[model samples]
Target: MTYPRTRGLPTTRRTGQAPRAGTGSGFLFVMATLSCVIALAGTYYFFVRTTTGQYIDESALVEAATLNGPAERASTQFLDWLPVISVVIAAVVVLFVTIMRRRWKAAGIALVACVAANLATQLLKDWFPDRPFRGVQTIELNSLPSGHTTLAASAAAAVFLVVSPRWRPLAGFLGGTFAVAAGVSTLVNQWHRPADVVAAFLVVGAVMLPAGWLVLRTGNRWNVQDGRGDHWASSRLWALLSAMAGIASAAVAVYSLIRIAPGFGQENSTTNYFWAGVSLIVIAGYLATVAATWLFGVSARRRHAL
Candidate 1:
């Protein structure tokens, strides 16, 4: 027996079912997950293991402490209720998708991954040693993989997972921004260091990438769509905007550090390091968003198997 060919995708004579789009999205996702893990490890080592990393991190935190007034007040308020707010938003979005779209398996996978990411973060916090006194006049508490950041990023990842393909680009962008806001807020209020927030983002990415792959595989009925042009939200504009923002933030971070390099060895800073740290959080959040958006966008089926 033989199967008719469709869209240049070859099918096995025995099974007669062509692979999903003949794309290497699964390989890309696995590579992306490994990259996330490696990035997390590097972040932890540099920030917690080395004296130079410690100084830069401490400098950023100390400079942030000097910032006050309306922005600080707003960040504090946002963090004070971050847990409740994140949970409510995630729950509502997940419930609506599962009930309305009937994405039972995908929803279960997403929710499970979300809980797992948060739990892993807490465990890491407990397991990691306190910040060693490498000549930096900072606190000794181990704050890597910030809990607040994990909550926000994982909540956003959950919503991103259950949404249909057409909305993923927009959902990813909005979700990334929310997570970035939570991270920057934590830094502004001294709740966490820059590395801690970035580590949290990596943790969510590492967990959700695999879960998202599962979602694409199982939710094929709804995941199939007419591509990005089919919906305004799925427009390539969202990913482009995110990439542009990430690039701009990266440039600012490098420039800030460069300007302050000549003034280094001094014991004081002028908010340069703090802005750099904030820029890092922004870069990581949006980088993950754009990567996930592109990965899912390509990995999802363009049309159902005939």
Candidate 2:
């Protein structure tokens, strides 16, 4: 079916067409915003009304450290690797889209949005420094707005925008799941309060939703244009850059896992399970990229043959 063409943009033989808007954008924006605001409010209550910000005293830290033993180590290891995995996934999505569509602009915009979400999280943390700990205590700044969650969610949203409509729901679900998992893990490990995760979600959603909308809208506009499109001079350069980003993110995840749980790298253990999961995810991502490339290639060839 032919879609409506948007007016005022530069027209190519293929330009001016606009696709039907998807429902995902509105749904994601509303749900993400609601979840984040609720989390922030809860955090505010804890910090203002209680001593949640106080650090465990030295003696308490030593005692708890001793009692928790390997469990603490395991939790730390998981958290460290989790962010790395999220980042790698995001990078892979960016690279896949760029290579298949030669849409470097969209990929760059996604990367920037991810970075901005993290930055926004940090700024919010500093702005609201009220911890809400519930144990033997010393005093320090509160850790509201979890950066890990923000980055994961923002990256997911950005990537979702560029995917084919048929794949969007699955992409969005995976992205949201990763973000939630990262946030929940932080809380479980005592690295972040419940409130912190909520705040992070809010900050990430606020930044990503609007940014995603604009990027997708522009991309749709471009896709409508007809011609031997002007290919960007640095298309290959961008692809390589995206691959590098993916590699770097994977490395970071490995480093984080090692730092959090040194034993995680040991052979034939639950740590292996985590590593295996990440590897599978990476493999799946690459396969998807290959498929997308093949499909795009086939379509291009058919058009030429016609």
Candidate 3:
């Protein structure tokens, strides 16, 4: 029952004790969910309540709108096709899991998670209080969660959830990149603000983390894959890429936010804020993806040992 160590991921220590059911991933899921909720709440507070938040949003809109006309038009066109692209990707992943991997239970859990995330997005968008005027020229309604971003992120998350642990790292990195690109496209098209995109990432992660555990809880055998020798999809390069991207994007976001703090009300330059928003989306998307990869990777190894 020994698992070949693959790519520096965690493996079970030689102990004579049995592992508890749901201990590994269950804790991870709860923590991940709570973090997402906290993020959503904080995003709402800053984006809706604070004057600086309003200014940031206004600046983002203006900056996004000021892109070159051809680039803007192309972004809009790309965003319009995003839903279709997401659906196609999700379908391909789900089919691959169900047919090649024969992971019916995992596929079901992934789909349910996908539906729940999108439904939660609609519910939050409708029931969340409208944004106060805040003396900003932005839209009045609460667009805390971007529906397009939610669709894209959740779809990518579904694909990530159903894949085998050996493949999760690569799946996570690629899926996260796709989701982030979709979110940035929305911003470039001026279809949604930065907080909205970040919120969407949180929402998807909140729902998918638990669903991932559920998939593992029921499909332990299928979750156990040969991690020793495999394709690029099972390599650690994706983990490295995701970690580096997350760290770099987070640094940029923190630096940009700090720099823009004292200059908010002075000059009317939003380029910094715009870059900050994009950086936030990158951090959110990649961090969440890597977290999932680690969480489920541990869960799979632990369950396999048991």
Q: List model 3 lDDT by residue over 228-257, tens digit each.
A: 535778777887898899899888877777
Q: Against the correct fold, how does model 3 do in TM-score?
A: 0.87
TM-score for every candidate vs. truth? 0.90, 0.54, 0.87
Q: Which stretches of candidate 2 lie above 4 Å from their native place? A: 1-73, 131-139, 221-306
Off by over 4 Å in 3: 1-23, 225-231, 258-267
- Tell how far residue 4 is off in model 2, in angstroms: 11
lDDT on C-alpha atoms for all candidate structures? 0.86, 0.51, 0.80
On TM-score, who's better, 1 or 2? 1
Give the per-residue lDDT digits (tens) of candidate 2, residues 109-213.
767877888887888777775544466453457566667767766777667656643344346445555665565455445565444555666676566655555
Let me know the TM-score candidate 1 reaches against the reference structure: 0.90
lDDT, residue 288, candidate 1: 90
- Candidates in order: C-alpha RMSD to true structure: 3.9, 12.7, 4.2
